[model samples]
Target: MSERKRFYLTTAIDYPNSRPHIGTAFEKIGADVQARYRRMEGYDVFFLMGNDENTVKVARRATELGLATKAYCDEMAQQFQDVWRALDISYDYFIQTSDPRHHEGCRKFMQLVYDRGYIYAGTYRGWYCEGCESFKTETEIKEAGGVCPVHRTPPVERSEPCYYFALSRFQPALLDYYERHPDFIQPEPRRNEVISLVQSGLQDVNITRIGQDWGIRVPFDERFTIYVWFDALLNYITGIGYGWDEERFREWWPADIHFIGKDITRFHCALWPAMLLAAGLPLPRRVFAHGWVYIKNEQTGAVEKISKSLGNVVEPMEIITKFSSEAFRYYFMRECPFPGDGEFSWSRFAEVYNADLANNLGNLYSRVITLILRHFEGHLAGSRAWEPGEIYEEQDLEATVQQVQGYIENCEYQLALQRIWQYILDPANRYADRKEPWKLVKQDLEAAARVLFDLVESLRVTAILLKPFLPRTAERIYRSFNFSRDWQQVRCEDCYVYPRPVDDLRCLVRPGPDGKLAPLFPRIEIR
Candidate 1:
């Protein structure tokens, strides 16, 4: 047998100036789903997540909190990891920019780029937005009426001596690279925006700023700190052992995917690749610029960007505390298109949770288990063993499974979930409604057992499909039955094809005192 392919994946490192909000959580969740899916597909996956601690804004926030910079960064990194763990993010490693390993790797990278002759001493005069921790182009400022549109504050005009990255020198190479690898920047709209920007022109960017104690310093120029973006983007390499571990670095250098927010597409697509080119390193396979999660204004019913100025920053913990992490995961992956923007509101969340989880999935699980336990003692006859096809005979099972696999491969998570519901869950729920297996138990006990078997088969198919999106919920469903395939060993192929007939299918779940499996998702009241 051949070896499994290594899949190195990462999400954009977030600033630890504040705790993570839902908008921040969205990108992580999207990346997590992909990582989980890849693992299920037999890839040796390395999922990396982290905090961007080296920033002016972070230092300022630390001072206001009356804590040392390192202490503040450490505390917030824990808080960030807490939410990720609570949501069941299966990241292989979490790297902090403030860590010694990262600092070492970052310095080595700076020196490599410098020695490659891409660095030059220069002076810059531009509009600098401290909130963004970067200089803004005049067009960007003018378009926003001289204010940073995101921060809603005027950018200060600043002039300082700094070191430059010869980004403009890489324009031809960048354009050629984009043309050769059209799939490098994902989601057609984002790819178009990046191509247009490269066609316009490339500008040499300032890679260093004078004397900041909180950030990584330029290796050759000790008097200056590396610019935050220049430092921040290096986390992708530093986390993977760019300088420290040669073997590990070579193994995972060209990331399978760099999942980032759409706001920073330009940097990842243009500047990041150029930096890699200068250092003679391979470019990441793909940079997927996933969209933002907006807030549905309850009063106005308009979806607006979740921002501090709007006073609508909803924390991930709030949702997790109120509902199960499974509910939080399902809602976002089902409602929000991963490649495009999605809106969130308490009302919408409740509606989806009730309709999808409680009514359809939860109700089906409870009804099927209760039927078997009540009339037949939770076991089908030991003599009964049948092929999976004999159970799910009505549907073109393989075709539907292939469709979902395709949707998932393309990162069309919302559509993938929708298709599973429409073709699989919805049909099962409707079958339950029409068959009324509870009522059939009275008429033909033998015939009713057949219906129960069919419904349970539906649950099996669903558990496999939902594994990546809702890991906990899927396992709960799969482990409830004594199936031929092990819960951990199952994959997309197992949905339609099986090794042998299901032998003496019996429920493995223990019931409560009342002799009933508990509801997976108890309905939530929005108020």
Candidate 2:
């Protein structure tokens, strides 16, 4: 057998300074879907996610709570894990920057660059934004009215002894890399932004901070701590056994993709790649910067960023509880376009949940099962008449499989779902309406059997297609048919061809013993 193609993917680790919001969860969910799809396609995949705990912010928060920094991080790490667990994120490993392995790996990686003559000691003075944990340019400060663009807080001016990375040395090399691989950064617009910034000129960046004791001690100088960005970026490789396990590291060193929020594009696209080049390591194949989740301000009727100060923070768990996790996943995937920012409103969310899940998907399943039990007395006698020869041919099911695959490959999740919902689900429902299987049973028994058979098989294919998106709901629909004994795996087969042993309807869709099945998603009344 040929070697399995290796694929390593990651999402930017969370800061763990606060409870994660829906915006944070959005990146995780998107990455998880991509990972699931790759696994289905038979790639050897490793997905990594983690938390960034080596920050002065953690120490500050600890002081407020009268706890040690490590103690606070331990507690906060659990909180972050709880959110990931709730979302059913399928990450292979979760790396904490505070981990001993990570510290050793980061120090080793830094030393490799230093020995290469890419790092040097220097004294630096600049305006530092504590919220961002980076020095801001004068232009950036002025644009935000003398405050940090993201936090709206004034930066503190500080002069300190530091170690700087010679990122300036890689200016030509970076431009050349971009020229050779135009697709390094996604969405074209982000690529243009990174290119423009690099072309303007490159500057050496401060890699170690002075008089800060809350983080990993610089290897050569114990008095200083590694800067948060430098430390956090190392987790991507260190989590995969980079420093210690050469054999394993070689297996998946160059990540296939790094998914991050748009705000951090500068670091991931420019700084991180330059650091890797300095270490004589391969750059990650791609960096995708996804947009934020903007929520509406209730009183002003204006869109606003979701933040603590605005009190516009949405509690993801509250929404997940009210609407199941399946609905939550479907809403975000279907409603949010991946390339652009997504808007969130309680009214829009409720509207989508009721219309798509409860009305479209839930109603279709309930109607199909209910009619089979009522008219056929839980027995479907499979005959040649039931074969969906022309109907299947008309649906062009093969093309749909290709369409969905293409959309996923390009990370166009919303488009893929829209095709499934509009083309697949809507057409199947309309077929039911045209045949009127309930009425057809009295007019022509064989004709009615054919209609129900087509509907049942269509649903089977839909459940398979839906697995990576709404896993729980898909399995529930699958089990309702009682064919759990037939197919042990969740996979997509040729749309027109049914998985065989189709001699009996009872074999395909076994009706519940009581001729009744529970509702999939009960309609919720919007107050």
Candidate 3:
């Protein structure tokens, strides 16, 4: 009965040059998990994701395809959204940087920062990577042995007339801000890296590019277009009615978290906040720099970045089609550590799927539901009086819920899932094995009913905890029983803090053509 607090989060907009790989989807899935968790905690959440279309690659790729620039961006945007939707990324808005409103807002913001003396005209000569569409600093080039770290290719030296943002001027202020807010850059290692970079020195960055007409133009000078990074970063504000809807923008301007990849922490944590400070806007509360998803060379036992040249890039849709949205979500969130690097291999995927989902969680669900349906015709007598026992004997219910909550709040997704399986669900499976509920039904009818009640309770608890991570599967699990509360209305703390009592206590899931409830997670065959 209190007002729901607001939570706004955004992921880095991807370049529309190519289809998104599993590596790209990794970041979105992590952000979606957090967004869903916040909603479950009763926050008014807004999730934003999009494509960065105002880059040189956009036009070049479009030209290669023989399509007009805008048409290409539109088509790619649809393709990107389709993949994200199919993966069940619950983003509220998808901003295309080429939108008229985005262009208008970017121009206005640039002009404001320009008038404030942070912007100046200059000539920039630096190592440039055409793939990333940005200038690389000497430090970056040297560390990576005279190549752009991301592209892993030598950056061309070029000179161009441009407008620069006076980022060096904010050096002292940025350091102070970091000192004051240690939590601004998440996962400790990223925070230290950002601090070290800013402490080394800040450089005034080129904000406008000449001889480019595909991007938003610098308002005062029509001859130059805005740099893609500068333009792309504005998506967070512009996507949420920044220049157009003042009332709406004010409500969500200072985002709770900017969910970006570890590669772009410098952009989000340093350049982004400085730009906001220049415009006198509040910075986003936190920037979470999540790790990458690499492809494991199963034979060689080596791990490498997902790249087309490497011939190891795995598309998100490839796995989503092969399995399911929930299965896709579960594999990454379970196998991959959220704040660190993870590897994906077909054999590893099958192993995790069968061990965690099929053998443990799904197997438990089928046996419990089937046993209840077969013996009691899907109704358990006096289930309302059933004192649902502990899913974990070592910890009480509230303590158990708190432990999972702590992992989620810190974005320790893999750990949270491990806790669920190892503590909550594993114990439930153990309980079934220990009691042998199926055999009890043949002799001790009343005792068997009690055992089924506890198993069903375990499933209910499991569903509530998994709702945010594995949404569709969670809904299916929750809807199988006649829980008193509505599925959507359920919250993370509901499992312990205020568990609603069961009512009719009858199986609500529809039986398949085989006259039996289908398996929630069918065992994946390892070929």
**What is the C-alpha lDDT profile of model 1 across 1-527, one tens digit per residue?**
23679899999999999899998888888889999988898888899999999999999999998999999999999999999999999999999999988888889988998999999998999999999998999999999998997686999999999999999999999899889998899899999999999989999999898968988878998999888888889889888887788878888878999999999999999999999999898999999999889999999998898888889999999999988889999999999999999999999999999999999999999999989988888887754544345434534778888899888878889999999999889888888888889999999988888888888889999999999999999999999998888887888888877755566779887789876578999999987
lDDT tens digits by residue: candidate 3, 1-527: 23679999999999998999998999999999999999998899999999999999999999999999999999999999999999999999999998999998998899999999899999999999998889998888999999999888999999999899999999999999999998889999999999999998989999988998699989999999999999999999999998888788998879999988898999998999999999999989899999989999987988987878889988988888989988889999999998999999999999998988888988899988888888888888563553645445424666777888899888999999998887788888888999999999999978888788888888888999998899998999999988887898998777765544455578876668988778888888867
Tell me, what's the RMSD of every candidate?
Answer: 1.6, 2.4, 1.7
lDDT, candidates in the order shown: 0.90, 0.82, 0.89
Clash-forming residue pairs, model 2: none
Model 2 per-residue lDDT at 462: 76
lDDT of 2 at 182: 88
Residue 80 error, candidate 2, Å: 1.6
lDDT of 3 at 108: 87
RMSD of 3: 1.7
Question: What is the model-wide C-alpha lDDT for candidate 3?
Answer: 0.89
Full candidate order by TM-score, most accurate first: 1, 3, 2
Each model's TM-score?
A: 0.97, 0.94, 0.97
Q: Tell me model 1's lDDT, rounded to 2 decimals.
A: 0.90
